[model samples]
Target: MAAVSPREERKARLAEAVWRIIAERGITAVSVRTVAAEAGMAVGSLRNLFSTQTGLLEFSAELMVERAAARVTAITPSTDAVAYALAAICELMPLTPETRREFEINIALIAETPAHPGLARIRDHAHTQLLDLFTRIAAMLRGETAAPSPASRTNGRRLLALADGLGLHLLHQRASDDIGWAVDIVRDELHRIKSAAIGD
Candidate 1:
């Protein structure tokens, strides 16, 4: 197979550097000059890839999504309900260093972009993705014969809300944040929703 082109390689390196900066300091460290310096290149070189500050920030957000998606997708082939549910839930939690960094960076971006429409766009997009993942887990937890009902879907949304809220709290260190806690919280809520949906 052919190797990646120099330009593509440079952009990839630059993006990775941006991740490192955000992960270590914060998004406040992400600028054309800083990112280029981190990438061991010139500011002009970095700008060749990202034309504007908005573009660079948006690409950083995209990297976060890519990382999150890959983590979530790892469990897609599993048929075990518990494992699948755990996998879905784990996607929201920052269990590893990489995930912790990504979530921290993304949250900082969310905070900084309040005045920009990109904030809502990226935040909503991430929420929608979480909802979809939770919906699938909700389905498995509901049982094979259960159908998707209004109450069930709402329950799915609620589960997503709980997970996101817990994840955010965990990230902020304002709550007792642990993987086990996140799992228990999700499972308990999933049970309530499933039982109510099927009238058990």
Candidate 2:
């Protein structure tokens, strides 16, 4: 393979530095100068790689989601429906140092979604996909034999909202160990729905 471009390597290093700073301090800590300092590069070179502040912020957001996706994909869940689901949900949280930084950067980006034009679309897309994921997890627990209803769709969104809310809370040191709690909540809702059907 061809050698990695110096520019590309520098961009990756700076992105990593931004991620680290965001985790240690906060997203507001991420700036051309700060990241350049962390990466031990001149701000000019960092700017050359990003071209603009928005570009770097946008890249960080994308990288956050990409890292989360990789974490989720590394798991191989059991065939047991609930077991499979809870296992998958475990992947979404910042369980490791690297993932923690990733989550931190994403949370910081969420705060700037309004002021940062680059992050608006990324935030929207991330939420949309997360809800879709919840919807799928709902269907899996319910089984395909039973068609998901309008109420089921609403429930799926609620579950995702809970997960996202808890994510932000944990990022801010407000909530602790939401991963299992979230999975339990979803499973409980599923059972509650089935029970309601049985009584009907």
Candidate 3:
């Protein structure tokens, strides 16, 4: 991999500081001063990078999406459609510490969207990407090579809803809790969708 530039490294550090503040103190605690302090940078220096708090928060949200997208994109393509679909879906859930942090940051950013309208665009973009992935998964499960049929599209929406609901629930669960049940729920849903597609 290529080396990270100085500016990119600084931005990444600042975004991580934003994520830590959101996870520990809440989004309301995220200000230029607090983030600068957390990142161990002077206030004036932070200003040089991020002129406003909104810009900082927007970059943080965009970084979160980029990180999640990278993980999903890294999944190895599998010959088993169900296995591939499950792996991709599970990557979105807060099953591990890294993913949990990502989800926390995601939820915080989403809640602040009403006040920071800029974040809504990032959120919408992420949602569209996820929905497209689900549509492709639906097509794969149905053993189709062509564009997704209307039924596959509907099933894709259903799968997305299920994943979203489960992810929210998992966020509230304790770290020690056995999340195997949640994975099973996703597996069951995938099987049901696959069966339905086969029937159609």
Give the winner by TM-score: 3
**TM-score, every prediction:** 0.83, 0.78, 0.96
User: Which scores better on lDDT, 1 or 2?
Assistant: 1
**CA deviation > 4 Å runs, candidate 1:** 1-6, 144-147, 172-178, 197-200
The clash numbers for all candidates, in the given order, read 0, 0, 0
**Stronger candidate by lDDT (1 vs 3):** 3
Which ten residues in a row are the worst by lDDT in model 2?
A: 173-182
Model 3, 95-194: lDDT tens per residue? Answer: 8888888888898899999999999999999999999999999988987899999988998999999988988898888977999999999999888888
lDDT of 2: 0.71
Candidate 2 shows a clash count of: 0
Query: Which lDDT tens digits does candidate 1 get at residues 1-200?
Result: 48989987787788788888988887777888888898899988787888987777777677678667876777666766666777667765766666667777777778876766776687779878777767766766777445665555776788877876877777766433456776787777866765765674
What ordering of candidates by lDDT runs from best to worst? 3, 1, 2
TM-score: model 2 vs. ground truth: 0.78
Residue 69 of model 2 has an lDDT of: 70
- lDDT of candidate 1? 0.74
Ranking by TM-score: 3, 1, 2
